[model samples]
Target: MNKQQTPITFWGIGAQKAGTSWLYYNLSKTPGFSIPPVKEFHYFDRDTKYPSPNILSITKTRDRVFSITYLIKAVRAILSSVFRGNFHNIGFFLKWYFSNYNDNWYLSIFNRYSGSKGEITPSYSMLSKDDISKMYNLSPDAKLIFMLRNPVDRAWSHFRHIKKRIKGFKLEDVQEKEIIEFIQSEGQELRSNYLRTIENFTSVFPKEQILVGFYDAIIDSPEQLLEEVVQFITIDEQSNKEFNQKSDEEDLPTKEIVNKSIELDCPPEILNLLKEKYHDMILELANQYGGYFNKWYLETYGKNSVNENNRLQNTIHLN
Candidate 1:
């Protein structure tokens, strides 16, 4: 348990499913960067309490379940506990769940190497301003990277991710009405309230310390994005290696699902509702960042300035 003398150099604070896994995988392989064996530290996102095994929110739960490897480990721990006449298995679970509270424990994860270190935990986006402030206290100079996608698309992906995780649930069998209700529900919608999350991080961290990227751009030109990230983090560009990770592949939240073969089951009505809800925010973000959001809106929904303005005007009138 050694305390880190240096602040964390980089972070991928996220809009999940937006190329974070690809970023983490590539950064881990890159030179002059020290990435821990586990990609998501869950340090800033969690507290020092026993994590509930009966977590209802799919997004809040860890992706892994009782896998063959996990089963073997559990059996070994149980057998060891019985022989030792002690509850070692319970201790193991506690340590794994609450490992982040120990500052030295978190630091030790990256202490094996001498280089710039960081973590890529998508759930950190849901953190409160107070939590982010605490994170700043831990690493005041940490550079934050946020990758965003079209909110509708991001939410849809998130829904699909949750759907895939439910045991005995086939996504195709899910009803459109039920899915739409779930999407519109507060629990799910909060994850895509990007405006609030971004503000929370930027309000504490200087705008220059935060780097916002787009998922479409990452797909369209990963090499450019890779180089930009490298330069931003001050990683040695001389050791630049090609991004071998399949950036094109969907970064599913759960390991149970491997591919994006499942056709998105979101109803057009639901999409329209989301667009109506988020269009103004989306437009503002696109305008502010000059990134892919505006272009994506144009391509997906077509150009309609008059209609959009009218929609805003109607909202004003209604208010």
Candidate 2:
């Protein structure tokens, strides 16, 4: 297909920290698949705030000498356009950034590939309704995939990730009582609300167009998960791809180690609260989408996961 006609065949709508990086790496390696060089383009979910035009506009009010310099640059740009087919200077890094957020610019990234093209931007799950509709309008045929983790587990992992990024941060240095409080405030609650997020997406796209898989299952059976994904996207089956672990995941802290480091293991109270909050949502998913998610929840979290338990039945609280 030509550049203009090319369509993205798949999308990894992320629950952040839910194996999106691993998925991106594996899919990029698969035969006949083209993934962007960068993982998170943030084009759809983030505002494209390139300041080039604003800078030029503000520069218009500068003194005579500066005005002359601007005029000279404009003239030079014109000459460069005519002689070298370059309308802008090579030093304009924002030009490249500006292009990244545009539809044509995104499409051009996959121009050389005729096979399945996709991107993994986990934050796309947080897109507003209008933006999601815009995405659907652009690529109605795209198969969307969302990988979910137990909300409590996902929230804890997210907190740990943020913890690592902050300067001088240490899990052991933090007070035991404050760990749950900090994670609650810092965690991405919107991401943890899988049912709502999926509902919003499914409202815009048909049920068959969206695939929701759990992180536990993906980690446990990645090859089988990927095989199902390949079938869903109708891409040519890949025989040589390894999906059980991230290609670059070596030397990373193990999940057990990470969990052990957290005191109280995310506070049983908060964990129970999260379970109660998401109980109805999970039940709806179980009833409507089948046992994949429900069964996974039961198997992963045990009896404490659902509201059917007497203690959790009265713990429902809305955001």
Q: Each model's TM-score?
A: 0.70, 0.66
Instruction: Give one digit per residue, the lDDT tens place, for model 2 in 81-173.
Output: 558754333323223333324566555555544578888778777766777897787777788888776666777777667676566776556
Relative to the unseen true structure, what is the C-alpha lDDT of residue 118 in candidate 1, on a scale of 0 to 100?
88
Q: Which portions of model 2 miss their true places by more than 4 Å?
A: 1-4, 48-100, 166-168, 175-187, 235-264, 290-292, 299-319
Global CA lDDT of candidate 2, please? 0.59
Displacement of residue 1 (Cα, Å) in model 2 is 13
Provide the lowest-lDDT 10-residue window in model 2: 310-319
Index of the highest-lDDT prediction: 1
User: What is the Cα-based lDDT of residue 76 in candidate 1?
Assistant: 69
